[model samples]
Target: MNMEDLTWGQFKALLLAHPNLHLQFKYAEDALVDASYHITEIKKAPITSVDCGGVINNWTEIIIQLWEPQGKMGGDAMKVEKALSIINLVEKALTLDAEANVKIEFGNSTFYTRQMYPSAIAVHGNDLIVDLRPDVTRCKAINRGGSCVTADKGEECCTPVKPKVQLIDLAQTNCCEPGSGCC
Candidate 1:
């Protein structure tokens, strides 16, 4: 993970520091979420998978989905306290991992729905803005000195190679047989 990766604990700490400020989200350059946005849901996903390096990986993520009311156009963003209250409510039903990775799920008329990582968090005037960036894909094998790609598409990195066995002269040795006492 990069320095831009935000954890659940860090996010909560940020909100606690500026409880009076309005919370806003910025997905792209100069692009911000509608002021009427709402924190609809908080999801905790536990993921387990095998990577390209044949390594087993496990991790968790906390995804917060934002939705803008279509009828409500221009309004002030919700306060950090309100958002934190929602999180507190969610915690009552589920145990959240503070160290889990954090993601923001959002979409608009022009943008498709996607889970984004928090690239930056800054205080601007009376608002606290969270800058989000699209999540990227990388090969774990390449990071572990194994090739991410193979000459043959059917081949994968770190695939186990089968061992070869040699034939022995069974008749010359006291090998077990169907009706023999050694069997």
Candidate 2:
């Protein structure tokens, strides 16, 4: 499929409406399994101070704050180095195992995050936790690290990853939102 043909809005909208649009993740060892989560939220922090929330580099995995920010479930409260470390894990794994996939679970058995972000994970001071949601099942297509099973059920393979985690890589962080002037 020609990704260039699809706009982010179209792509995301498709995802939101898709019956199989699900998320997946990996761990220390073992094939990538679906991650379980209680809540999810998106916040913006300088790439240098971002511990969770929002996708860092466009190609890396997405992050959700797992700690409460001043008693709020969703607010600015994370560290950048920590965020990069998590991104590094995903990059490292994708490089070594291009076939990796991730799964995410949400609270209340909803495939999507609750309208009210749950503060459970964040209250513990843990980084954003990765997991699968109950409402949606899985994304329909997977060209990169998606689910343990490829998007098309044994059709597409993962994309190649560039070398990462080197010190120079961290210094080269760029804005991720294309054309939005953020990156």
Q: Highest lDDT, which number?
A: 1
TM-score of every candidate relative to the true structure: 0.78, 0.20
lDDT of each: 0.86, 0.30
lDDT for each residue of candidate 2 in 83-142, tens digit (9 for 90 to 100):
344545545554422212222222222122321211111112323322222233323333
The window of 10 residues in a row where model 1 has the poorest summed lDDT is: 145-154
**What lDDT tens digits, residue by residue, belong to model 1 across residues 66-125?**
997787576679999999999999999999999999999999888898999998889999
Which ten-residue region of model 2 has the weakest summed lDDT? 115-124
TM-score of 1: 0.78
